[model samples]
Target: MKPDFNAMTRKELRAYILEHRDDTEAISVIVEKIKADPNIHWYKPEDTDRFPEIFAEHQKCREDARRNQENQ
Candidate 1:
């Protein structure tokens, strides 16, 4: 289940994602939620302008991390 992004603060959102980071489906859901809410995660003056680009970069980083992971 996705967190109520509309009702959650940025800190709460981060904690929610961090706790469920291992859950791929859950992570995707929350990420989409943040993407849909343009106002969310909007911290710092620059983030408002750089959010889309930064989010794309971060997504790529996560995908690269996943691809490089080895079963332990």
Candidate 2:
């Protein structure tokens, strides 16, 4: 039986998605989660000047998440 993607943590879901890249349902679930995040920032084509700052923040978030996951 397949695991419940909706019940998985962000880290668990990410690992599952990596191991099961063909699972459209899991991908859709992750996409929905991302879309539902209130902290998500949308960048426009004209916001080129802010791209570096935006990407740096994104990288920091990824690193923080990795550290938190490791500590767990």
Candidate 3:
């Protein structure tokens, strides 16, 4: 199930990824959603109120997939 970014907390989002980190395709879908929103992922030093661990993990998944495809 996709975590609704508007409704879920950062901690919850992180936990969601921890459970589903292996599913890169699903994460990609969510990443696209976040990217489309823009405001949901404004990262900066002042970003104490927002957490981006899920976003980071999604990026890492995409990068790993690219590397794996290249290696193949």
Candidate 4:
């Protein structure tokens, strides 16, 4: 039986995708989730005024990741 991708957490889905690279459905779900995440920001070249905001967001994401890893 196929696993229910919707029921899986992002971390679980990531692990599943790595182990089953051929599962395009799982990949699609993860891609959609990422696209819908509010914390994610896509920077554009024309948004010059927003560079600082974008950079700060990126830095915050990196720091949060580091903290999560350290806690783990």
Candidate 5:
């Protein structure tokens, strides 16, 4: 009755995990896939010097939205 995780896309696998948190086998498959995937890498701040400026702009947008919400 169990679904085949190997046949599923990453998004489908994630959805499966959310629906079946108790399924350890599916969780293991996702974890292993992530670990084995060379393309799945962490971001380093030095790699993107523009991150601070981009983050600041994001924060300003959030603050402006919060203020608008408060005014409405």
Candidate 6:
């Protein structure tokens, strides 16, 4: 008998995938559940005011690294 994927938690589903790599149906169910979950956000949007300052700092660091590389 096939296990009910819908009843499994994300961790259980992941373990099931590792154990049953050939089960495409189980894989599909996991993908669909994750997509349907509203709380499964990968990245939260940062505050815009802080974001620009952080991005500018990152850009400056990258530019400095590139200049140092070119000088070497």
Which stretches of candidate 4 lie above 4 Å from their native place? 45-53, 60-72
Model 1 lDDT on a 0 to 1 scale: 0.68
Cα lDDT tens digits, model 1, 1-72, are 665665776577678768877657556656777677654444588677888998897788777768878533
Model 5, residue pairs in steric clash:
none
Per-model CA lDDT versus the true structure: 0.68, 0.89, 0.66, 0.90, 0.84, 0.84
Worst 10 residues of 4 by lDDT: 36-45
- Model 4 misses residue 26 by how many Å? 0.5
Among the numbered candidates, top lDDT falls to 4
User: Which candidate do you rate higher for lDDT, 1 or 2?
Assistant: 2
| Candidate 2 deviant stretches above 4 angstroms | 52-72
Model 5 lDDT per residue over 1-72, tens place: 998899887789999999999999999999888888774555676848877876787688779879999999
Candidate 1 clash pair list: none
Indicate whether candidate 1 or candidate 5 has the larger lDDT: 5
Tens-digit lDDT track for model 2 on 1-72? 999988987788899999999999999999888888886877889888888998999999889989999999
lDDT of 4: 0.90
Best-to-worst order by lDDT is 4, 2, 5, 6, 1, 3
Better of 4 and 6 by TM-score: 4
TM-score for candidate 5, residues paired by index:
0.54
Q: Name the lDDT value of residue 69 in candidate 4.
A: 94
Rank list by TM-score: 4, 2, 5, 6, 1, 3
In model 5, the runs with Cα more than 4 Å from the true position are: 42-72
Q: Report backbone clashes per prediction.
A: 0, 0, 0, 0, 0, 0
- Model 6's lDDT to the true fold? 0.84
